[model samples]
Target: MRIRLARPEDSAALLRIYAQYIHSPVTFEYALPTEPEFAARIGRISETYPYLVCEENGGISGYAYAHRQAEREAYQWNAELSVYLDAAAASRGRGTRLYRMLLDILPLQGVRSAYALVTLPNAASERLHASLGFRTMGVQSEAGFKAGAWHDVAWFVKDIAPHDAAPRPLLPVSRLDADVLRRILDTRG
Candidate 1:
């Protein structure tokens, strides 16, 4: 598997992987967005953060990204993390590879803390986050309704870098040198 930055062209494959989670309690989304909407989402996120996809044999198998944790400027140093892997790609360590690359890149963008909100009973996801040094902060019971029932969400957090009283503005992924960005994804933990 190879990890690289996400492209708008990968939206269809990315949506396919994400739509599956919407049906299960793994995600809170009720309906899948249209292809154009999804493409716009990819474009919007890549503007200021790291949105990555893992390709295996030339097909997108997994993806991960970090977005603003809150809209307020006070939250600039914090971001929410998300990851999805195709069913066929699960159990092959693709999620780890994608997530590690995302985590590795966010700090370079001035992110001090990264958070994940995982739907309850998702042992696999919880384990993956925990294995990467995230600590369970708390669980929000019945935070969302999905699949005709209420589902809880577990919040986990990891500090990627030191927090300072004044943090520099986040650096867009596009600002990073091509060779440096390539090395970041290609080098393994």
Candidate 2:
């Protein structure tokens, strides 16, 4: 298996993996985005954040990414992470590998804190986050309504970098040194 930076062209395969969670409480998205829409999302997100995909046997097995946790300027140092795997890839450690890489890369982008929201009853996702050193902050009961019922979401957080009194401005993923970025992606756990 290999983890690499995602390109817009990989959207179709990534979208296929993401669609699996649309109907389930694993994700809050209620609709499957079109290939073009997903491709555009890749382009927009890659501009400032790390967008990664894990491929195995010449196919994308899973994917993970981090985005701004909130819009305000003070929240720039915080990011929210998401990961999705094809049904066949579950329980195979692909999600862990993908998240590990993402956690490694985020600090380089000036991200100090990484967060994740796991919908209730997803034991696998909860285990994954906990295993990665993320502590549960709290749960928002009935945070979302989907699939004919209400779902609760648990918030998990981990400090990826030290919180300094004065932090240097965030560096976009695009500005990271090419060699360093490549090395991070090539390094496997």
lDDT of each: 0.88, 0.93
Clash pairs, candidate 2, are none
Q: What is the lDDT of candidate 2?
A: 0.93
Q: What's the C-alpha lDDT at position 122 in model 1? A: 89
Provide C-alpha RMSD values for all models, in order: 1.2, 0.9
Most accurate candidate by TM-score: 2
Worst 10 residues of 1 by lDDT: 180-189
Residue 92's lDDT within candidate 2 is 95
The candidate that wins on lDDT is 2
Q: Taking the tens digit of each residue's C-alpha lDDT, what string does model 1 give over 14-79? A: 998998787888877778988898999999999989899888887888899989999998888888
